[model samples]
Target: MEESGNAIGFLENKTILITGSTGFLAKILLEKILRIQPNVKKLYLLLRATDETTAMQRFCNEVMGKDLFKVLKKKWGANLDRFISEKVSVVSSDISVSDMGLEDSTLVEEIKHNVQIIINLAATTKFNERYDVALGTNTLGAKHVVNFAKQCPNFKLLVHVSTAYISGEKEGFILETPHKLGESLNGTEGLNIEIEQKIIEQRLKQLKANGASEKDVTIAMKDLGIQRANQHGWPNTYVFTKAMGEMLINDLKHNLPLIIIRPTIVTSTYKEPFSGWIEGMRTIDNFIVGYAKGKLTFIPCDTNSIIDMIPADMVVNTIIATMMMHKLQPPYQTTIYHIGSSTRNPIKPGDLLRFTCQYFIKKPWFNGDGNAIKVKEITTFNNFASFHRYITIRYLIFLKVLELVNKASCNCLEDKYNDLKRKLNWVMRQVQLYRPYLFFNARKPKLSFRVILAKSLDLMTPT
Candidate 1:
């Protein structure tokens, strides 16, 4: 196969099927493909919906309706809808199910015959997602995708988007390596997928027998996920299941062309489409939001620790370039790419804090009362022990006092005590979920030649 210098040429007249069309990365990928390669044969967006109508509606409202597509809309003007109608097709499918839960045989056959590339971006990103849900959607989900890929005679490549934290809480340089079946980060034994599934089933059955409420069931499941992950030496349920997903795909994808991309802490867009464009509060954004609202006074994090992060647009560009490269020069086996900026352009938590403070000071956040909220420097703790101590002394003690006072006053301050207690619990939970990243010590993920090549070609711009 001859190599082509132009990524646009590789995408020209090529049909691509993308799962998780409603996700942030998927939306950017979709917008980029249509913007750069309008001549592309077709875009098969596989969204989790009841039917094609609902899928199309979601594509319009959730995917294309975002400000990310403003550039394309400007260029296409009145013909944008017509262009999308001709080039895009929304398919209702679920990656967790076999055959992607495709009910329409005709649509399924058309996809199998036409799709040249399949990008598996569907996943449950919640760090503490339920064990059953995470296992089904993340681990077994990759297996189902590979099984479907085997049925596609025209399939050239399958790109599985995964997180770099799937490496777990490690301190040294992480390499671009495949996770062997049953491989555990901390060398735990008997990490069998079948046994794990059985464990989830047993737990659920016991909870159901006890007549657990919906909220209770959710809490139990979340706690079970964390317990299982800890038993297998992983930090959280999301990374543990994702690692298993890679293992399953590698074991089953015999001769299939596969590329696994592990991106670290994906942030807002650096450039392209627009700058500073972000969908929801994610990762460090949570801290920023809390601090801007004068709610966050302290956090558990190592200010000196480097946070490996890459812009959304850069990750999207790397995916496109990787796809083109793999299609042009097919690898002998599955290839892994770690898309992040830790090694090349690293930023410490302290730097991020300073930047946030500087920005908010110039333009302070306004309150509901139309008053500018005062900003203050936040206190950071390097370890959980110190943070816990501070929380107990500062907030928990105050809450205890309030509880005593309310009881003495015959529950007169009940509402205030309840509100304060609820806020404290919420903050503690958020900190616990984000503890891994906040004090992250991972040095950097070693980049592959393909990733270096993409960067060299300016496919991924430095921030």
Candidate 2:
């Protein structure tokens, strides 16, 4: 983990349970744990599956089989299977359900007695996911994990991986301290978790009873999440529900050894476990891909605004360090740390765009016609109206003409125009969902990261 050299030793004989093995952050964390401390008593990966066989399959196909673990695979060689079988085990469990939804009593007992560390990484990262799914997995899921943690008699620490955006719309100086109970980081009154859950459930039940179609249900729930999020002072459903998840942990911690590490816009690995390794398109990666492909010419953003991001490996290192530091300490209160780079080494949107364009110029992507697409300077609009106008003129106008042509031609174009219109509508939805984050220009001057880390890490911040 590239810590101060003792995290691995500290985890020597510990049994650890980690949720969210399928996620990018958890994948890197698992690889690092196995690569660094092979002697760990047992590292259980709690995945969503029907049985252990399916869980193992997912563990192999999604986690260990990825390129991130190539080095470890080569190191273990012929004994790779044996080592993994002995040191790593996958337990099919969904945190959204009660008691982590573990049906196997044998496995439950195994974890209750042997598991000393619990790292909950399971979360729905979709910024515009359905409210029901988001609330179920992000909010109630934390409650279920907390309940399970209480059952773990030997639990040394419960590390809940959260997002730094839990601060919501705060302008500057987002602190690393745990947000106050019953309030958002921005000082907005927080929702009662139990009450909110009941409200969502009742609303969903009413929708179903009213004979709402699935499509209507999805749209209604999406709008509800956004409306609630805006009313609650958060940016979107992802951050809003994650904040509730953190709140649930806060209410339920009850003197347990807990460390909540909130990382910002997690990207690829910086150095360890293979540099520059990343799985799916993360928060900012989508923007990079769309821009490089020339599909996204306009973005609503303040180019000079600082975009905080941290390498995945750095986050993993910090997680390990936090766990190790807390393992030997007394059972204390909850602690939160914001793991990000903006306050220390800020990367502005303009800088990111420039780097992205330059990288594409050096190693451009080829289009379907077998020619490298020439990268263009990104155009940033100050507001959504300007962005919408640009998109309408640049893309929608042509589609509109095609629609007229298709109509005049009596549908001779075979729904091509209709398909394009559908795609454009979908793109518009995504843009709307991402508008606030991309277009934000905080009034608060800046946040001091170095000092926050110094305070949060107990003066042992990673180098």
Candidate 3:
């Protein structure tokens, strides 16, 4: 096949292996590629499953059946089945395991021979994921993918999808470069990964030795992950482990064509594969849904803080364009691409708040009683102390009154009120946990904010 300036022409005959095909980003990538370039040789979708049958089921239900692929479905019509059979294949594998947990030698050999591009998109995005799980999937799992790439004779590019937050609780400009673990940022030394990993292992062993229940072990591990993250200067386990994954790739990418795409808070599609298409609730979407339902009243945030967000379809486009650039322009070295909008077209928390209110005004939501839950202007706080004070003075005192009433009423409503009290306390704890990001004032000289420089994709940088 002759490669041309046209992206579809360039991608015509190359086989691609994509991990995390069931994920949000990967599904969008897959749909865009199939919809635009049906002539591409094949797509190996690696997903975690017990067998190929189960993997196919997941691909059909979770990926193809999703609203993201509706445009493609309309185009293919009666030929959709034939098109999918010719273009897509599912491999039952887990990124967290060695050799991608592939048991079949024949299938492994097939991948080794035909796969030219490997996209590592599988990762644990849970902010408080268990330490062992995060380490194995994000850190060690990445190492395994690199090893697999080393064996592929035709491998050309490995595009690792990462997050911009991997810069990790730092202020000022974050360069498009791989940062080493324990490397000083602003005169502060980064976390010692080796020592931290050992600490986590020891804590788990101690918990097991104490005959802790499974639930207790899980909770202990989650808490330990967060503690280690904060102790080492990072905000959470998700970003810390993701940063480690990047470091692993950096060490192993010697002489290989690798590009790391660090995208900021990914939102719905802006243009392609239909507009405003999004899956289940993302980070900020949680607040939107809760607020719309009138479940969340007060939130803690600095209105002026810049929150970098990029549309999912834009990320998919950038990924494809970057891959094609690398293919067309050979001898390319490892590069980091920060695909975000802050540096180009900044969007603030205040802007999002305004948009949400405006949207709901045009399209109001109603409660179960069939009454429009006319949303009031959401109250915001500048700091955790102030937010905590408000919660304590208003909600906590009210709960205390309920407790007293229950005590006076022969414990009549005590059980129900106690449950509500516990839930309120949990919400307060979550608010406290997330206060740093919410109330972040990037303008403060001492405060840290991520600055992603998007120099890689000069072709379509946001205006």
What lDDT does candidate 1 reach at residue 408?
100
The sequence of per-residue lDDT tens digits that candidate 2 reaches over residues 88-187 is 8789988888998899898789889999889999999999888888988998999899988998888778999998887776666677666544675445
Which regions of candidate 2 deviate over 4 angstroms? 1-5, 184-190, 327-330, 392-402, 409-427, 441-463
- Give every collision pair in model 3: none
Find the candidate with the highest TM-score and give its number.
Answer: 1
lDDT of 3 by residue, 1-463 (tens): 6455455566788799999889999998898888777888999999989999999999999999898888888898999999999888899998877898988899999999999999999988888889888887887778789889989989888999988887766666666777674553334564566676798879988998999999999999889888777766668888878888888888887777998888888999887777798887687787787667665667788888788788987788778777766653447488677777776677788888888877877778887899887777778877778888998898888888998999999999988788777757656655756655785533211111121112123323221
In model 3, the runs with Cα more than 4 Å from the true position are 1-3, 181-198, 327-332, 367-371, 411-423, 441-463
The weakest ten consecutive residues by lDDT in model 1 span 454-463
TM-score of each: 0.95, 0.89, 0.89
Candidate 1 segments whose C-alpha is farther than 4 A from its true place: 1-3, 327-330, 411-416, 449-463
Ranking by TM-score: 1, 3, 2
Q: Which scores higher on TM-score, 1 or 2? A: 1
Tens-place lDDT digits, model 1, residues 136-179: 89998899999999999988899999888888988878888889
RMSD of each: 2.3, 3.8, 4.2
How many steric overlaps are in each model, in order?
Answer: 0, 0, 0
Q: What is the Cα-based TM-score of model 3? A: 0.89
Error of 3 at 264 (Å): 0.3
